[model samples]
Target: MEYRKLKDQDQDGDTNEEDVESLRGKAISGVSLKPLAAFGVSSSDRSKWKRKTIVTFALTILTSSQAILIVWSKRAGKYEYSVTTANFMVETLKCALSLAALARIWKTEGVTEDNRLSTTLNEVIVYPIPAFLYLIKNLLQYYIFAYVNAPGYQILKNLNIISTGVLYRIILKRELSEIQWAAFVLLCAGCTTAQLNSNSDRVLETPVQGWIMAIVMALLSGFAGVYTEAIMKKRPSRNINVQNFWLYIFGMIFNAIAIVIQDFDAVANKGFFHGYSLITTLMILNHALSGIAVSMVMKYADNIVKVYSTSVAMLLTAVVSVFLFRFHLSLAFFLGSTVVSVSVYLHSIGKPRR
Candidate 1:
């Protein structure tokens, strides 16, 4: 298959040219045609390739759709609820689900019980540190969300890349390339443009505090990723599932305590069991998925790539928020976000594989 594709590429020397023209024709005709001839795919393998592409594209669309829904929910007047309680409950549920998932994977994969437990414990212990930081960040974020709109929060979130880059250099002794730095700058500019032109006013009273909290949250998340990578490097054989399980366990405990203390007034004001809605449920699920995604990336990919991917996620989040949530965008945001995305992608490609 590979040889045939290479041969075809060499022979035609204009495969791209042909493909572009074919695509244009297809667009103009607006009729169904065989995939094989359309893109020079061999008829014998066209079905397989079509299926693979469709599946991959479907999954991407699904994931992005879920993200869009979550962001929209936040914008649709869901921030009125108490952050601490909501996050604590969500984290707790996620931790429990993660533990269950690890157990099932261990059983199926035939991993040693002792190793699983040890790895699980490591996850439990380490997760809280970042969770604590995340909790702080989320609280600030929710506050910001309450004050500003989705676009502003999305833009500010790009600060994570900058924060992560600095922390990685300090903690992991990892240096980013010029391209990576350029991407970070672009992402920052995009975020700034989005925020500056936002119709929502900063309201001076809370914007500064929110900004401080958001930056702190970004720094904490960055450090958490670096720390998790360090831990994973030391235990290369450990399953990511086990590591994530323990991290969530520890995070749950810490977050639970913080929630109780910080939201004491809200709990009293709204009663201990307020705001248990579908939105909260979805938010918890989102947090769980995020934890799983981060752990898997840290375990399997280069740490630099892992951090850079976060920037990609941010950019995607912003774009989705704008289009789906009807958030505003500006030229500065376009140019800046483009720079950040390119820089991050370049850095990821340039990174040495483990």
Candidate 2:
């Protein structure tokens, strides 16, 4: 969904601009030099980098898996569920799991009950903004699924990197070199190549409506991501558990509202579980779990890691898609893919700004 694509984090939004500048430099340098991410930090910071790396890899897998499942479910046919219902269930489950996590943290850490409620409330007050963004993003992505296939979805989705970079410059007042811009351009080109030139099946020839949704999703994801990162940097000490709980609570609430608005008629006419299946349940669970994984990565890592992970996931999705979607490859797809890979690698390993 657009939620994963957006990299949106709910709760907490503050940052020491000076520290952000310092850390941003390191994040980019580390990413470029090691092609791993955030390596410019000293040994003292290695622990954090390690934490981020593990989270990045995990989220990458989870994110890609969710994409795979969505396409797989679509192809399976003879079974489906309301997109709104699925999104609502996922958010509800996510919120419940977050509450469970909060309970465990409270028990293990011996925090007082009153303080916990206060923490959660604090997060709710701040996170609703991004949570609402998530509401729209989630709905948009579901609509996108109706029009585009999995591989096309993945390729077009990588455009989020370009969106992120543009937002980074405008919102954070950061500057990028020509080289950095070129890499972003290369990513766009590769995704376009895969989408346009692929002799692949129906997924590649997404309708104009689908293209519009994907582009809008990318731009929204970019804005939402930068906003979330800024919030985390602003308040470095915020409790992630508290933040996540409120984030999903708001998300669940918003999705419920959307359901009432959009699905109420259909649901009342046909009943809520009319098209329910084990696959739908699994997809709901998949979305809920993947949401947590992404939030972790977005909080612990930076754009470099997130983009790299998303890029890798896109590649995997495209490769696996050939078998799953039964589409043939094209030369332009391979050429574009190679160019994208090389560009991302070179940019990551490029010399850090003086």
Candidate 3:
């Protein structure tokens, strides 16, 4: 990812004395690069930081709003429409968007030898793997709301950070520092503390089934994220829109199959859009945008930025839930969220010194 000093090199691959002299003059005119270098900030690093900041902000908004909208979209305890159908619709939308972007690229860049292999099955076959994994993880997103409220879901979702770290190391052969390992332990303890309720007899508000589903969802999310990252990184030169198109194409296929298997009779009895409302439409848009945002994060930024953004969203969701859903902010929830926030910071900046 490092960029060489293009201005200092000529077409003949030799140093340009004129360019060096020009830079030297600029330095003489009170434009020294030493101050920036002193802080270890280069032009490339600044560019990267800017991109990461923008993507992190987008992720924070998309993630927090999506969680809130999902909870609000539910009527009573269940969704009137088929969850599988909804997921299928989201994937279809994403595929369309990615295709449109790819078409724009083709129009401007022209289809050449570089992208000729983009759509072939041999090149795109790995997409379906993460697509299927995402299908399961997304379905659980809707189903888990049945057991826990919005804030509780936000807190529990952090479990994926732990699972992601494990799979990221195991599958990608990356190394985590000892501090990051302790941060994972702290994250688990924070989630457990969030679930504690002094007023309830059972201690935890979420049922056993809810915990099971949450664990399964975390595992699926971790694996899908790591796998998708692997696929994207495999072809570092490939356009991300092409990758997104294939992934979403397979996502739509898998979700369609799920709809047929699980909701064929119900959809036949009513309709695909039978119980959909404005809230439902908004939820669909939120999910579609969220998926696109996550893909961009994986492509442009690393998962550490994603973790920080989602961690901020966790707090944002809890705050929004208080006014919208009348969610009580308990002492345990505060302490737990504080701990979770600390864990996230520690994990993000806990890398070993070079």
Candidate 4:
């Protein structure tokens, strides 16, 4: 009789313990049984997804609301003091506060020595790049705002979304669905409508240098988002408290450099120790709160969703700018903004439930 090893079966000829253990190990180790599935989400699921849908909707609303509030607070006239000097001061203070917050969290949580040092280095290296870029961006934005009004600035800034989307697709190989693409197009249309001939009355003949600087600023903001996302993914479980703590430390370093370069005289005249203007105070609070909000949201939500939420805020700002500032509101502006809003809504709808 040919002694064939009878397929590791039990006495009843069922699959034996060895076979069962092997299968379990594969599952436990993340070896998928289904080859065709993407991101481990099977196509067969239908009734199982109701909870995810509800949760995503709730999170989206929360994210959009927070963004709107932050934008409003930042744009409020009280926070719009002399843009360059005030922004540098605000960023410097924000960095200081953020580092303090991080240290408090670290002391409470008792991080490992290795983790502590790594976290410190993260802040040291990453914070300043974005801070300086953002300072420059804000400076250019205010310069533009001085000439063209808030509505125009809001419209132009929406172009950041376009740039971001392109970068994501090209650099990250993240693919968007057809609906998402349509949403982006609609957003562009809305922004165009919102800005079309909106600045006819007050053309300040803004220097080409300013326009270049503004575009650079917008690009930096987009790149910052991408870079932050990348960093978070690399260490998914890293505490936001620690990350933000380091962020502030590095931010302070860069902001200090910026202050010296841009506001040395202002600091000397006002006394470096007593430079707490009302605008600077609001900005510090704004940065601290907004940083926390953004870090938490990014932890739970998709990057694209976060980006789109800013679109909603931009739309609100455009509306507020027209009515509150009494800026021009032509038909083109209205139509474009409407299209962009619709696109944003559609994009929000199509976002995958986390």
Candidate 5:
């Protein structure tokens, strides 16, 4: 009687019986996807989620392998190319591959001629900043290697997390909670403790210059890493291939300039691949792929994730060093490993309180 009375009161009411029944059923069933929607995830689709998982796994493997390969390649006695020269080779191939891929994408999707000029101009203006930063960081690594051992380099470079966190706040204007800051400090301390060398001879051999360079690299790398995250976030829809093509073009150009400046006549006298071998090519390809891999990580996530990735790679390198590279594993390594493990857990599980 009451329902009929209410229905009769609204003469032009358009909501039908079927709609009411469907909504009532939904309310009873508690069918809600708002939580998932908030995270930008679709609860309705499982396949897309699985694909993302696979990609992340692939990235982890690629990142870890790249770190090991770099150490193994450079220290090996037979590689003929100079470090900077080899870096030049890596950037060249990286740019070429990216350009080819971009061309394929453009041909398939069809480019807008009107936007071509703007795209070119933007690439010209913005892309080189990161590429030049890359050049500086790479050169610093070589200098660091000259002054210190691998362990020292890893320990010092891990400080990028602190710098990254600080800059992430300033540049992105996203504040970190006290807990997050504590976690970052814990992470740095743990990694540093873990890689501390016990042997005095190796320590004494590495001068203060290497230590200073490593710190400088850490600061610069943090800025570069955060800057990359900002770029991806600002243009989330930008084609990764197109952006990579521009970025690598500048990288190639800058690296070429570095090689020429370091040795003015080497290009004409001996050629780009002077004393190069199969190993050099493999190393170059591996490093190039790593560049792509890290960029993907930065695009999808943030520098914090990349920092953990480097930590994992560092741990793996330490293991490889112990078994194959004939490096000593000190007590600090075990303790530091434990601390770093805890830090990773803390960072993963700790949530910001509302």
Candidate 6:
């Protein structure tokens, strides 16, 4: 299929070019797809929904588990392992997993030009931009944690939802309805409220530097997500695993560079597995899986869908923490979770303005 035709079909709401081609073939054979719309649902719509639901669910689970495991792995007040080194390992692991998946697909289908590892420089060049943005954002997170408490960090982090929505509109030229814009605001507000604690003064004591770093981090996150979706959707017929492989390649490169700049001596002295335990291992796996899951969501859904998944994961993490760590769940959290739920529903059903 020509790239223009594939792009047009994507804009028409087809999740996969192969599915669109299949439907066209059936239509040519005198099978009408119009009848499927009589029940208010089409095959393509159902396929898209199924993919989004599965990927979003996986992301939610992986994100929530990662949070819990990170907390569990902390020794005294901090991690005994080098965070930079662990992040490098995570990128490396994600790259390996992508390669493994690509290998399986090749073995099953036989490698064609489409599935082959060979690609033009233009095809893979854009991926490094997001990888670099994410590297900076991840590094800034550690710095922000020094000046802001967890609650404050959560509140500030919700700003990414707004930034993502704005970037999604500007980059994709997709118009959102007024209700959806309102829902974006509600999501940010709801997440902020959920993380607020009236009894704690820590959230109120954030320094100017922390606020600046948090804002920059949010903007970087939003830009990276939107840009990634743009690239994935650019060639709808491309294998997602192939795209993931290129993405993880740059991610591994960037993170390896970061490790060298930040923690080379520590890793050399203590070795890579110095502070790794069962819980830490699980945390690394979870982190790697989450990165893959995010790429899947970008392929199957969009950045907005990812935002919703992570927001819900935050609530789930809090609920689970209450049981595992005996953490308190205040009325604010309950109210905020309710609002987040409502906002998600509104956005899911939100129509695009004509």
Best by TM-score: 6
Cα TM-score of candidate 2: 0.74
Q: Alpha-carbon error at 305 in model 3, in Å?
A: 3.5
Give the CA lDDT, 0 to 100, for residue 94 in model 6: 73
Best by lDDT: 6
Question: What's the lDDT for all of these models?
Answer: 0.53, 0.64, 0.66, 0.50, 0.60, 0.72
Model 3, position 71: C-alpha lDDT score = 56
Q: What is the C-alpha lDDT profile of model 3 across 12-107, one tens digit per residue? A: 000000111222234445544567668989876755555555556776897788767655754234446666677777778777777766666667
Better of 1 and 6 by TM-score: 6
Candidate 5 per-residue C-alpha lDDT over 1-354 given as tens digits, one digit per residue, 9 for 90 to 100:
211111111110000011112223444356454655687776534333333333344446655665555556557655444555665666666667656655555576666542121375654577677666766776666567677766555456666778887887888886556766777788888888776766534654567777678668777777777777676567766665555666666666876687777755765687766877765666566566666656666665567766776666667667877777797877988888887788778877675776
Worst 10 residues of 1 by lDDT: 9-18
Candidate 2, which segments miss by more than 4 Å at Cα? 1-43, 112-117, 120-124, 134-159, 174-177, 198-217, 322-327
Q: Can you list the residue pairs that collide in candidate 3? A: none
Query: lDDT by residue for model 1 over 1-354, one digit each (tens)?
Result: 211111111111000001112223344356344644778767546544443333233323433444555665656554455655654554566556656665565666666753465634434545556555554554454466665556455455567667876877788886666666665566555545544553534433446767786677677667666776676556766554456556656666765686577778888888755766676566555544554444544554444555444444545766777766687766766776766656656655654444
Supply every candidate's count of residue pairs whose N, Cα or C atoms clash at under 3 angstroms: 6, 6, 0, 8, 0, 0
Pairs clashing within candidate 2: 11-127, 13-231, 14-234, 15-233, 15-234, 32-348
TM-score of each model, paired residue for residue: 0.64, 0.74, 0.76, 0.61, 0.74, 0.84
lDDT of 3: 0.66
Which regions of candidate 4 deviate over 4 angstroms? 1-85, 92-128, 132-155, 200-217, 273-280, 318-334, 351-354
Error of 6 at 165 (Å): 1.2
TM-score for candidate 4, please give it: 0.61
lDDT of 2 by residue, 181-235 (tens): 7877887777667556434556557888998898788877777777766655555
